[model samples]
Target: MSELIELFKDPYERRARLVPALLVALPLLVPLVCVYGPRNPILTAVLGLLGGCGALYALASVARGRGKKLEEALVKEWGGMPTTIALRHRDSTALDSVSKRRYHEAFSSKLGIGMPTAEEEAADPARADDVYIGATKRLRELTRGGRNLLLKENIAYGFHRNMLAMKPLGVVACVLGLAYGLIIAKALQLAPLTFAPGKIAAPGLAAALTLLISLAFFVAWVFYFDKDSVRRVGFVYAERLFECLPSLQPTMPRKRTTKSTASSDGPD
Candidate 1:
């Protein structure tokens, strides 16, 4: 959790988190103020909370994005490795080999892993492979625990994005449902639609209930149908990138050859 908070401390992350909250909150405030602000500050505030609910998901997305960047930054900071090798396998990049080489050199220098020699590369390819593979493996091990956390964050953010997109409809539905219920209650004088020690009439229960139901429906849709599809897209991208890591690739077993087959397999 502390790590998650630290991730959002970045300026880019803060922007990602804050923009969505403001987008959801501002429009929500207008209606709450116009309708209930004059009559009941308490109810208006409760509605205000619901209005900005989508912000939580946006912040979550920012955390995942930040975590991903931090994961790469750590690997580079440790050994000057390019974590993009894995990510680039699935994602597109326009960087040329020269730029990648220069970046790797500078990155390694900052981390105190001086440049390797052509003699070293040619003379001991296996040793160089070990070094690179170890670096990549360390990175994966460091990030493995956070994989589920990041996936949950991404999946949740997708759901929140859907909810925000449906906000106009949800808000309208809640308002209309409340209005209709109140009309019926008032006409039938259904228990005065109020309950308190004094004459303080609380009018937002119906709206709150309606909003709660809408939220539940949205959550269900995300969990049952939408989450799997969204998860698959994220999984595919991550899997492809992870596969690019040397240590993550699978090794195939060599087939045993019969004596006759072995004789035939020898060079002419």
Candidate 2:
């Protein structure tokens, strides 16, 4: 049961759970409260309890989708790689360790790149350009020929590239979400759709409407923006795979400068 709960912990899953309940309740609640409001408190509470079930259903569906997306991404990245890949197994251990030092140590050792010191390990994930640049440079120095392949294929390097792009995008996403939420809140205050007549009391109704509208816009924004962002991040990841590893350096095509030919008559 605990494991099952942990499975749906992702943000996508949580939002999925919340959105559906709001959608269902948003329509039903206004009617429900109007019909059997302050007069029948017990019945209203019971119905509210039952309505919460929709949230659970939403959570399961969203989590399944997230899991599927992750699996598809992994399948695409893994391609035809063999089952005995050391990095595959090493990743599990690196994730389980609590300490940043331990995680980086395990990851670097697995990739045959020397581990960074404690201070270096403590660098912020959002801005690890200096750390990765230095570590990647050292990784190149230590490699002879094919050893660089290890760094090229390291899952951490891939995630780092993906998340590096995601960091700023995430901030922008949050700002957009907050703005959407605020707009909804303001709209609710201006509109009078409350249970009571002149008093305008229905907190529940206001919350539901705001959530429904704000979430819809947020989902639309993510669909439009994040799809392209994912592609660009993947490109950066592939670029990093080539740049970080010296073994693949020679394979990269060098740009040639075009030379201009002057007229012999003009020179004379």
Candidate 3:
């Protein structure tokens, strides 16, 4: 866990994975907090114990793993990855054919590799996909940093992707919280609306608030997350990545090395 302490400083990890994780985790903790009381030393000690044992770190790691898997699944569901789709000549959703041509030329120049030709890609689409994946990886390495707009776009995509990945767990936490809240409210004989003058205990009010919060989170997950939105963010990130091409210094073209050159030069 101490070795992973540096991970805490990574903005991508915190904002994209840890924050959503905590949102899901917090609702689950509400019931415990209610039972133990907010200022209870016992509750504080247990939290400390969990933190010391690296539970929170593990949760983030697990969430990140799931997010990655889900992202890959999404890419498959969408026919191809955003970057790959951008590189493909056939994917009109990615870019106009002329723009894609320009993009491929720039990428070939900057990345110091041959961009897949439409004819070649048509013959071997899988190989073309490999080339696109490699180019995207190189681009990411070249543009990695806080100041880069591409990195910001990457963070944005990651946040949405992970939030969607954590949606099921979030829903579970919301359900648990809502169930406990409703039970507590029913036991206390509290009405959601007051038709006449009635006093609600502090606990009843707290339970009702918890129910409302849980419902809000459930609604957000239901409405705000889906395949289309995630794909949109992915495309935006891919475009931002491609836009970094101009920033990279172009690689020198490889010189021709043919048998004719060997014959033209004096033998060593």
Candidate 4:
């Protein structure tokens, strides 16, 4: 399972999609060929083509799952917080001069909003350059360990976004599978079968069954994995976030230390 997951990490790789496509396509194709290919090569070819397409879609699903996992991991590793500070003066005309002065001061002292002066123009330019110097303590309270908390939040957000994308795709795949099954069933009824004497009644039935089963599996997978995975990722991310911000930590109730008065009884 670990190896399989590792293989999925590079979603851009064609193998990820190809493997799943084969898995689904082979099973469906086998049943269809056995049932329908004795006399009509054309029908068999058509079924194979359809099965192949379905297989490709199955592979895409696997790739999507892998991509989500990889995205989350990357976000977590980065510690997801703003590493640089952008500062802008109140007047637009004074912005460039103010920015240059601040940049020079920060570079000379290695203090205040830590961002490379050269890269400032190239980076997220839309980001406001307002520096709330007094908010350092509060910012620390909001995001502890600076980057670490931000990284977790970013990862959590990624998981949530991926889950949202998967939910819709799962629904669409299931619906398409149903429609495909109906179309195949109608096609089978129109075509005559030429199986060996006393053999199974229909060949196309197997393909339909395979598709339906795969569809069902995918739907179940989405429901079982997507939301729960996102929730788990979010929970861990939240814990990490809180750990960074000391103020977010829960205050334990203080235990009262009662001093007992010992009455000394003389000659007791």
Going through the candidates in the order shown, the clash numbers are 1, 0, 0, 9
Listed in order, each prediction's TM-score against the native is 0.29, 0.26, 0.83, 0.29
Model 2 clash pairs are none
Model 3 lDDT per residue over 109-193, tens place: 8877677788888998877777777676666667767345666677777777778989898888888887766666654333563
Estimate every model's Cα lDDT from 0 to 1: 0.39, 0.37, 0.71, 0.41
Q: How far is candidate 1 from the true structure (C-alpha RMSD, Å)?
A: 16.9
The weakest ten consecutive residues by lDDT in model 3 span: 259-268
Off by over 4 Å in 4: 1-164, 187-206, 233-268
Error of 1 at 140 (Å): 16
Better of 1 and 2 by lDDT: 1
lDDT of 4 by residue, 104-155 (tens): 3432232223322445534633332222222222233445344644554544
The residue-by-residue lDDT of candidate 1 on 40-81, one tens digit each, is 988877765753554454544644444344434443443322
Give a tens-digit lDDT track for model 2, residues 1-268. Answer: 4433543563333332333333323333443464456788997878756545453554445433443344345435643111111112232321233433443443354444444343443453212323343333333334423434443333323332233323333345444443433433443233554233332233344434444544554554455434344334333333433333433322322111111221110000
Query: Which segments of model 3 are wrong by more than 4 Å?
Result: 1-4, 187-205, 252-268
Q: Which should have the higher TM-score, number 1 or number 4? A: 1
How far residue 56's Cα lies from its native spot in candidate 4, in Å, is 9.1
